[model samples]
Target: MHVLPERIKSLRNVKGQSQKELGQALGKSREAISKYELGEREPDPDALVLFSKHFNVSSDYMLGITDHIENKAFGKRKPYSPELYAFEKYLKNQDFIPYLQLAVSMKDSHLDINSFKNPINKLIKQGKKQKHPK
Candidate 1:
């Protein structure tokens, strides 16, 4: 069986949400949700993102690309750490060539990747301060 249909149905059932309710939450029609669960249709990318956000599971989990439901780094929770989420989103949307080049340059310069952590952490702290100013 295809994992998408099974996972969607299972997650809906586990959440005690009827197809109508799930559809309402996802801005999809109940019939559409049923079709998805029956494997008669596959969700588009937008719907897939909605499903992932609604269920708090990774897209990989929904597609069965990975068995792990929650990202170990984030755990199963809402309001994921903004800094981490932003970084993750950035990485997902970016081309890897620049990153690869940077890595090679860093190696040539004898720079440790770990050295960036402190500066990144400082920026995160600065962002928090700005967001929640005293």
Candidate 2:
């Protein structure tokens, strides 16, 4: 697994626990703490849960599977909304913007790249015309 050593270390620092203290608290050897912080090995199931609870983060965040760590009780990151994710993906996709522009443009609104009036070019021309009408 692509666990985050630096993230773990950051959490450890936040918790203000020394390696020996944290190892004792987690019921593991000090060397285990070293391994976890070095990214040499991931924590076991029980230890994984313990770490998540200790750091108040999602297991996915601790495992580096997701970049989000939400605290819905406190409204920290809003628990990683799939809708927001979809919208973000759509907004970032280059095709989506031109398609939207093409749909909105009243003057020959066709966004296909091969179209005679490219939607992006049409939008740009419209903007220029609006700004500098003769």
Instruction: Report the error of model 1 at residue 2, Å.
Output: 0.6
Clashing pairs in 1: none
Give one clash count per candidate, in the order shown.
0, 0
Indicate which candidate wins on lDDT: 1
After TM-score superposition, what is the CA distance of residue 65 in candidate 1 from its true location, in Å? 0.3
> Which segments of candidate 2 are over 4 A away from where they belong?
72-75, 78-134
TM-score of 2: 0.50
Cα lDDT tens digits, model 1, 29-92, are 9999999999999999999999989977889888988766674346864334334544566667
lDDT of each: 0.80, 0.72
- Give the lowest summed-lDDT range of ten residues in model 2: 78-87
